[model samples]
Target: MNNEQRLLLLEKAKQFFRDEIVESHITRACAKAGKLSNYNVNPFLFKYLANFLKGNDDPRSIAEALVLPRVLGSSINTSFGMRIQKLISELFEGFGSTTPGIDIEFIDAIDGSKKYCQLKSGPNTINHDDVETIFGHFQGTINLGRTNNLNIGINDMIVGVIYGEEIELSSHYKRINERYPVIIGKSFWHRLTGKDDFYFELIDAVGDVALEVDGTKVLEETIDALSIEIEAKFS
Candidate 1:
């Protein structure tokens, strides 16, 4: 696609993400947590939203770093990670399932086979123990499938880590690779979007959104609402 077309597409994607993914999920979480109706106006939310609305680079290492995971929790890392994971799944248009052992489960339209996906936010976010735990679940799925004479097996699983360097698995963990290999960084993005630069393009789109005049106004409004909510809730 041409530059203009790409930008337009990105804008649409941004809007979808903001409305369908981000806003919807945040609204539910805030309601459940009994926060302000517009609690999403906080700094962490604003930073990422403003960056996307204005198309600027995210100031924080992780976009949602400042948002709290729990009402009283200090960090929003987990929340941010979950959002990213959901965004990726949305980008791929995959079916999200809360299956016991997998984060997402979908049918490969080409092969007519089911695929289970496990997502991690960063490279080092997963360790030996994490792999083992997931593998145990995977094994359970396979065993159950076999006992029931189902078609599911090792070939149907994929593990993806979103950011950071590739994982260096030791010999013990390497066996896991035989059944379900972990994909990271470029490989992961390429597998999902068929474009190695998809990640960079997304970052650029976010920056571009942050640069828009209308985007700035939205940020200001969010901040105003947030400020009012904070005063009413805490004071």
Candidate 2:
């Protein structure tokens, strides 16, 4: 995209995020700034008002909407949080003994970013990459795991099934062709949250639900790349 097109897309995305997340904060800040401006507005400081407005209305929508996860690693251990676990349990209950549980050790929450809940178990070993791939098929048949106390976020995620299977590490690596990537599609996100907002959709991309990440490799990579772009722009 050209600079102009990029800027336009950014504005549209920004407006959408502002409408969803930060409108109240912006309004309050502007109100306070306006009050100060009306009083003894110092000449040098008056110029800052315009700059402040520019900062408030950032051109990148994703950037404006981006909410960072706490860098200090944490877990969701509340009663309401486990509701997600229950949801997962129900989702996978009919899927032939697929036990899904959340892994609190690696939970990360970021607005406008995919919230990943690391799920682990025996009999099936679904790793991070596998989880990313399975979530691609939200509309189709999926078996979500059963667990209680899943945390809620602007976007939410849950744990699915994990079972171990014998594998030739060398062969597996060769099959990946130097790209051990997990692909998730936009359709899957839409199925999860029914919205094009990337972050919100990603939050719900877990549980007993399983999508073929390998099958949707191209689209998944595209979506992930776009996510990276959005993150960088916002950062």
Candidate 3:
């Protein structure tokens, strides 16, 4: 990519952080607090006493456990995971595949060869089932390529992780890594755009955009509102 494409990609990442991460999380949190945060305290204490008795649990923690865990987890695992793929596609002028097992389809930055990548947000993102699923998907991609005479190699099918060291990979990912090339963190970002510092730059972009969107203020307000709601309803 040239200078223009690089700038555009940077802007897009910042936009995603502001709109998707900050704004969307705030909206969802407020909505959830409004809906289910009014549970009766008597029944809640009667029913949830066991959960909070031996642990240092309060209404805030209890609420987080009940509502915020799934909400935040889905935002990171599904939403951010998806946007990262889209940004990588934008960087390479390619697209993520709808084809099973191939989350990313692009030409390598340094080598300029087509790559089929199974993308993950973290080293430990997959389970045993995901390992097997990726293996099957890679095999399918290879077979499809061969049928079309595209000369796709096993090495062309890789697993790309957004943030982690190779040694930090979980057993499931390690198993997949044994069968296919696994690229992580700085190396993975470098593959998308032939720049070693791009990973740190991307992190900086997110952090900068977060502040620009008043992420701190909104998040604190959301937490305070949630804590108060939970205390009123369940304390």
The lDDT per prediction is 0.56, 0.31, 0.72
Span of 10 residues, lowest total lDDT, candidate 2:
67-76
Clashes of each: 13, 35, 0
Residue by residue across 101-203, what tens digits does model 3's lDDT show?
6888877786888889988888877787887888899999999988989899988999999987888989888888788988999888888888778888888
Give the top-scoring candidate (lDDT): 3
Higher-scoring candidate on lDDT, 1 or 2: 1
TM-score of each: 0.52, 0.18, 0.77
Q: Could you give the C-alpha RMSD of every candidate to the true structure, in order shown?
A: 9.7, 20.0, 4.5
Q: Rank the candidates by lDDT, best first.
A: 3, 1, 2
Q: Please report how far candidate 1 places residue 160 from its true position, in Å.
A: 1.1
Question: Candidate 2, residues 92-151: lDDT per residue as tens digits?
Answer: 232222223333212222234433343333222333465335344221112231224333
Clashing pairs in 3: none
As a whole number from 0 to 100, the lDDT of residue 49 in candidate 3 is: 55
Error of 1 at 184 (Å): 1.2
| Stretches of candidate 1 exceeding 4 Å from the true structure | 1-9, 16-76, 106-114, 167-179, 210-235
Give per-residue lDDT, candidate 3, residue 68.
50
Pitting candidate 1 against candidate 3, the one with the higher lDDT is 3
